[model samples]
Target chain A: DTAVSQTPKYLVTQMGNDKSIKCEQNLGHDTMYWYKQDSKKFLKIMFSYNNKELIINETVPNRFSPKSPDKAHLNLHINSLELGDSAVYFCASSWTGATNEKLFFGSGTQLSVL
Target chain B: GESVGLHLPTLSVQEGDNSIINCAYSNSASDYFIWYKQESGKGPQFIIDIRSNMDKRQGQRVTVLLNKTVKHLSLQIAATQPGDSAVYFCAETYHLIYNQGGKLIFGQGTELSVKP
Candidate 1:
């Protein structure tokens, strides 16, 4: 079984169009995270939720919002996406929120805004 | 603006040769470090990790070395293989006192190409 899975492996949309990506993990982990990888392959953390509580929120734009209905699901919703939103989004989960815990990542969703 | 960066953006090595990727971190307070391997069209996978209390940690074919004085870390791969061709990233974690989780800062990443 896939530990972490995200839907819509690839997404192509025009600017100002809104889109949403869904993420789910069967690892039974308490913490989940959303990361964005740019064209340069630089991965940056965007948001994190621990047991359905918002824990980490980076300097991302207001267009990006993350909602976690439960610990096993964390979904990303982008409003009025811009060209700069083109990047690969990844979903990750860990047993706990501790730094020592290793994170299991999903395949990732490639988003392209034209 | 503390960040983790790599010395080289790309490294090419012959199969069966040893490969070393270097990373430098500016945050002295970072006590935990991890190495992740990312293949083309895939997300980053955990390879190995080392803590500030330890100088070195060894995995199956990977070794991580940490230098607290210079705030430097390195990942050494033994007997590089074609399957090892991927972008390697080094991340430093700083624990947040108020929050339960730690903030992981990733390096620019080094692409390793193994030629047979």
Candidate 2:
């Protein structure tokens, strides 16, 4: 079974459109994260949630909002997506709340904003 | 202003040759380090990890070395095969930073290419 899975492997949208990416993890992890990988392959954390509570909110713009309905699901919603948002979005989960723990990542959702 | 950066952007090696990827971190507070491998169409996968308490840790065919003095980290792969070719990244985090939500800072990444 896939430990971590995210929906819509590919997302193609217009410049001003809004969209959401869904993520789920069956590992029974307490912490879940959303990361953005730019064209240069630099991965940066956007947000993190622990047991349905918002934790880390990097300096990401307010356009990007992460919502965790429970410990197993964390979803990212992009408002008025811009061209700069064209990149791969990854969902990850770690068994412990500490960042030092090993993380299990989903394949990723490739988002292209035209 | 914490940052982790790779020394090289890409490295090409023979199939049987070993590969080494180096990374430098600016955060002295980072007590834990990890190495991740990312394939073309996938997310980063955990390969190996090392804590500040230890200078070295070995996995199946991967080894991670940490130098707390210089705040440097390296990953060495033994008998690198074609399947091992991917973008490798080094990340650092501190356990105590959980109060700040605990973030893992990833380096730019080094692309390892294995040539047959």
Candidate 3:
């Protein structure tokens, strides 16, 4: 079974369009996070949701919003996307909130804003 | 604070040889560290992790070493194979809350290529 999964492995959209990426985890983890991997392959945390509660909000633009409908699902909604929004988005889950828990990540969705 | 960082952006190794990837971090409060491997068109995969209490930890073919004095960490792979070729990242566990998984601060990845 896939521990962590994300929908729409590839997304291609024009600039100023709106899009959303869905993520789910069956690992029974309480903490879930959204990360953006840029062209340079630098993984940056955008948001983290713990038990459907927003916890960490990085320096991301307001156009990017993350919504958690439940403890097991977190979705990202992008508004008026720009060309620079093209990158890989990843969903991750961990068993606990401690510093020692290992994270399981999904395959990722490649978003291309043209 | 920027918690995790790597020393190199790429590392080339020969088949059947060993490989070592280095990282530096600044969070003294961080007590856990993990290494992840990511390939093209894929998300990051967890390799191994070590807690602050231990300086060294081992897995199947991977070994992680941590130096708290210099705030450095390294991952050593034995008999590196082609399948090991990927971008490796060192992540620090930054605790922000109680009774939860800490946030992972990932460093700039290092692409490892095992040439035959």
Q: Please give, for every candidate in the order listed, the TM-score of chain B alone compared with the true chain B.
A: 0.91, 0.89, 0.89
Instruction: Give the TM-score comparing model 1 with the true structure, all chains together.
Output: 0.96
List the global CA lDDT of all models. 0.92, 0.90, 0.88
Query: Residue A107, candidate 2: how far off, in angstroms?
Result: 0.7
What lDDT score is found at residue B45 in candidate 1?
96
TM-score against native, each model: 0.96, 0.94, 0.92
Model 2 segments beyond 4 Å from truth? Answer: B1-8, B96-98
Candidate with more favorable, higher lDDT: 1 or 3: 1
Clashes of each: 0, 0, 6
Badly placed stretches (over 4 Å) of model 3 are: B1-8, B97-101
Cα lDDT, model 1, residue A69: 99
**Candidate 3 chain A, which ten residues in sequence have the lowest lDDT sum?**
A94-103
Docking class of 2: medium
| TM-score: model 3 vs. ground truth | 0.92
Judged by DockQ, which candidate is best?
Answer: 1
Better of 2 and 3 by DockQ: 2
At residue B111, what lDDT does model 1 achieve? 90
In candidate 2, how many Å is residue B3 off?
13
Residue-level lDDT tens digits of model 1 in B13-106: 9999999999987699999999999999888999999999999999999999999998889999999999999999999998788775767898
